[model samples]
Target: MANNQENTSEKKKSEKKSEKKADKKQPNKIAKWFKDLRIEFKKVVWPSKKTVINNTSVVLAVVAGAAILVGLLDTGFLALMRLIYQ
Candidate 1:
């Protein structure tokens, strides 16, 4: 029927329009990503210098403690191996 044909053609035209609209949005995706990144960066709360220094000191102290523990364990294991083998 002519009506069916007209309806089908109209559907095809709308699909083409939608496809073109989607194509136009491709370039905006990168711009939108950077804009969103800038907005999120603005929302970040940075630590103060004193807070940073305190955190850094805590981290270094923990690292030093762990290193000493590992060293002691290593030395004890080596001494045991020497006593067992010799």
Candidate 2:
């Protein structure tokens, strides 16, 4: 009986210690998270104005090419449908 009571008290003490440790770290964890995010954002190398303009032009060209290709395919498909349905 005494051994069981001692074990229960010991368990309670350890749990309280764990709770205190977690309470102490709560603010530190948030501060550390923000610090890490700031560091990661600083590490990013943003594109220059010239590079951005060149990339934009390339994207626009690709979109135009795809649009033309799709239009042609659609016209051919419509012709084929008309032939079969008529």
Candidate 3:
């Protein structure tokens, strides 16, 4: 029927219009995302230089302690293995 054809044609036209609108807004969406990211970055409270240095030194001390403990365990295991094989 003619009415059915007209309805289908209208639906297709509306869909095409929506697709075009979405395409046009794509760049705006990206720009809005970057703007939001900048705003959030401004809200962050960064650590002071002295605080950063203190934390870094603590981390290095812990890592060094762990490495020495592991090395001692490895040496003990090697001594045990040599005794067993001898």
Candidate 4:
């Protein structure tokens, strides 16, 4: 009878442990995602305002240059095609 009581208690303890593990496994995903996002954002190194503005200007300039180059190429190709068809 004592051994049966011990076995029942051991089974209950194991059941409690498994419950705890199951609870841990079912974490609130949204809370976990926000927690991970906060941790990652904390790790980021932000640039200075002047550096950001300078980089932004550089990007705009490059984009404008690329647009102009593409426009010129398209116009030249259109003119060449017109001459060939005429």
Candidate 5:
């Protein structure tokens, strides 16, 4: 009927308006996102291959030293505990 057609027409108009508004905002949103990404990427510190290798070696050495220390402590504690209990 005429009333149904009028309602649909109004709905379509409102939808078109909303779509246009969104279209207008899209560029600004995308521009800001890309700008932020660029700034963050610029602030990143890139390590050289040598630096990376040296850091990795230092970490591994520290981990091995700590492991050996903990193992020795565990063994010594067990021996002391056994002596005390006996």
Candidate 6:
């Protein structure tokens, strides 16, 4: 019975030590994460102004073309329906 009591006391001491170590490490972990994020952002490649403008114009042209095509199809369908009903 005495040996069992000693063993339980030793386990409790070790658990408290581990909990203190974990508390100290929490701030270090957050600092390391922010440091890694800054390094990763430095490695990123950004697009140039000319390249961005070219891609934007291409997207706008395609959208305008699609809109015109849909409008034409809608008008043709409406005319056909009118003729059939008359």
The numbered model that scores best in TM-score is 3
Question: What's the C-alpha lDDT at position 58 in model 2?
Answer: 100
- Sliding window of 10 residues with minimal summed lDDT for model 1: 22-31
Question: Which clashing pairs does model 1 show?
Answer: none
Tens digit of per-residue lDDT, candidate 4, span 1-86: 99999999999999999999888867776679989999999999999999999999999999999999999999999999999999
Clashes of each: 0, 0, 0, 0, 0, 0
Whole-model Cα lDDT of every candidate shown, in order = 0.99, 1.00, 1.00, 0.96, 0.99, 0.99
**lDDT of candidate 1 vs native?**
0.99
Q: What are the per-residue Cα lDDT tens digits for candidate 5 across 1-86?
A: 99999999999999999999999999999999999999999999999999999999999999999999999999999999999999
Comparing candidate 1 with candidate 2, which one achieves the higher lDDT? 2
Q: Which 10-residue window in model 3 sums to the lowest lDDT?
A: 38-47
Task: In angstroms, give how far residue 37 of model 1 lies from its true place.
Answer: 1.1
What TM-scores do the predictions have? Answer: 0.73, 0.81, 0.92, 0.64, 0.60, 0.70
Q: Write the per-residue lDDT of candidate 6 for residues 1-86, one digit (tens) a residue.
A: 99999999999999999999999999999999999999999999989999999999999999999999999999999999999999
Displacement of residue 28 (Cα, Å) in model 6 is 1.5
Q: Can you rank all candidates by TM-score, best first?
A: 3, 2, 1, 6, 4, 5
Ranked by TM-score, the better of candidates 3 and 4 is: 3
lDDT of model 4 at residue 83? 100
Candidate 6 TM-score over all chains jointly? 0.70
Residues 1-86 of candidate 1 have per-residue lDDT tens digits of: 99999999999999999999999999899899999999999999999999999999999999999999999999999999999999
What are the runs in model 6 whose C-alpha is more than 4 Å off? 74-86
lDDT of 4 at 20: 92
RMSD each, Å: 2.5, 1.8, 1.0, 5.0, 4.6, 2.6
Please, what's the RMSD in Å of model 4?
5.0
